[model samples]
Target: MQQAPTVLHVGWMSRAVDALVRSGAEVTCAVKPADAPAARTVCARTIVVPDPTRSTDVLAGLARAGLAADAFDAVCSGLEFCLLDAAAIAGDQAGVSRALAMRDKFVQKRGVRDAGVRTADCAVLDETGAAATALPSFPQVLKPLDGGGARNTFLVADERELTAALGQPEFTAGGGPWLLEEYIPGVEFQVDGFVEGGELRLMSISRYVQNLIEVHSGGLVAHIVLPPRTHPELYAKVRALAETAFKALGHHDGVFHLEVFQHAEDGEIVFGECGARVGGGRTDEVVERAFGVRLHDVWARLATGRPSGVTSSPGHADDKVFGGMNLSARPGPVRAVPSAGEVLDRPGVVYAEVSAGPGTVLPDTTEATNLRAGLAVVSGADEREVEDRMRRLADWFAAQVAQETSDTAG
Candidate 1:
């Protein structure tokens, strides 16, 4: 334990490398050959595998990188799609089975239900059913059994809609297995939680202003913590639900992100899905800004078998955030761009980044990939300040697009 623990991180390069390195871990990444350059810039060493999604292939490549059966102290994957592979490999390193349970949606969900955690009723659908009698009810959700975010995730109202959804490019491209579930109608919330030494601690919960579907469909992305006045009760509910999921999945170590819903009709809380990794989006950023402890640090320590390095912070931003928002330019010409310099000048603005320049072409707001034009990670004196700043920044972005488009038309 005196030496820096070597961590073999599987999947795409991400902020995790920096966090683990800062924690004194020697980081080596096993990534797709195409991602080797980016991974090398961040990771201490890189091992390029032909296809990172295939666990067996990655293990073969890791062997080529001189990775032995006991080569590393810990193993993990950053990308959701690669978690399954990360887990399979982690089993060789950690000699544990936490990886498989959390890798497949079908397996993960069934485990939860068997353990008595409430989840959306679901069925595995590997092939399309008769269009006339496909669903037992309307408003069913169809998604890949192992995909993340809202990729090919569709809410269908009836049989005709089911056929239409099945035909969409996203669904068809998901390839192979699928899951159809009763659409849970409720207030959606994403929870970032940690489980260490068999104990589950809810770290951050951000309520989404737009359901993931809307956010992924291309538009604005926003998530804010609840005011402390209502946080205690809400936090308790989310924590209870998360703990149940952690135990059900045998998640004894590391961090997890849980997707949950508060049923709008029955006022009951239920699970949507959960990840054995940090939830995507600026979640890690929001959690760090609000809490002051970097999530990456915690994850690295956990994966490397080191004690946690985080000092817990207030559930809600003690004095900082109303929430965080990512502003996206609509699909079109980026004739003009907003100045991050001006945004920094605004009071209560904690962080901001504008990713486009004049003549930068923007794709139509249709997915998370296109939401990167303008991004703001905010923390203010209070909720009102955060809200007002977000609105103002959003307006400036819209105005920039409008004026640019008008000039072009003229």
Candidate 2:
């Protein structure tokens, strides 16, 4: 029998590591010390690094572990922060370039625009915290070049708001050169899929319950998958957009989580941004349940220079539409919250994870979209049914959670 391929997996995605092992590969994980324990449980070997996001740290850790770059047949990371580092270690110049395009918002949008794709007009902020070009219009967006989860992202409606935002400590302190973009007013949709050898093998699109920008104002972060059969025109547009954007960004092989906007008025699809990794939250779970394909499995195979087992025709196990929700708590001392089992037992609920419960203290501020107290995946026979179930689940969860009263404050 052929010897299993030796793979050096970076970061700490348990699912990806598990997929690599299941694919007959001997996986060696390079992860931060905090994740070493969990990595050991799944990988054949583990190299502890102080920080996986830093290429120097990862390189030094590997050397101390007595391993060379040639020791592994492939190097890959499922985490956003570690993508460029993994590419550098693997000596994949193409991968490095592609990773940069995906990580830096300005570079990403520029490339997509150059490819004749419609995207938000953006410019890089200079050292004085001023846009290098004139602002596109009011309701402009300001965000870190490499930020994720909508953290440090701002929507300034006018000059006064922009001035206030620019004076904020997060912007003034450091982390120079942010990206300023004209906010695209539309319904946001995400396209999740795998591209191999410059060809899109599988694609799935989902519509967000609300735009991500609303998260700052106490909005729930959730989305429902759109079945292709029900929305063929949307699927076609999204698929073409994804393929064009990926090709422009030089991402030939890997999983992608791409965000796009459909103009609220003209209904024209515009590129929002894209990530050369799996979507966040329970997106993988929702996709797998809806389409019967594990994105991580496809990513692992592509990383190892093997053929992705995914075919053009993704066979769905059932006709149920799926969706995911990030459970958030109001700022306070949590008195009680529903258990994961309680949530999973509900009708159409397939998966649930409750991280906040009795005695948990939630912070007053919400900065990121992924700052969840828990998560859940639900399914129904159609989009409306799935959406209704998601809203009901959210309401039910809120009703179950009890916060400490002001009188109880110590």
Predicted model with the maximum TM-score:
2
Instruction: Enumerate clash totals for all models, in the order shown.
Output: 2, 0
Cα-lDDT of candidate 1: 0.72
Model 2 spans with C-alpha error above 4 angstroms: 1-3, 315-318, 405-410
User: Which numbered prediction scores highest in lDDT against the true structure?
Assistant: 2
lDDT of each: 0.72, 0.85
Query: What's each prediction's TM-score?
Result: 0.88, 0.95
Pairs with steric clashes in candidate 2 = none
Q: Model 2 — TM-score against the truth?
A: 0.95
How far off is residue 229 in model 2, in Å? 1.3
Residue 48 lDDT in candidate 1: 86
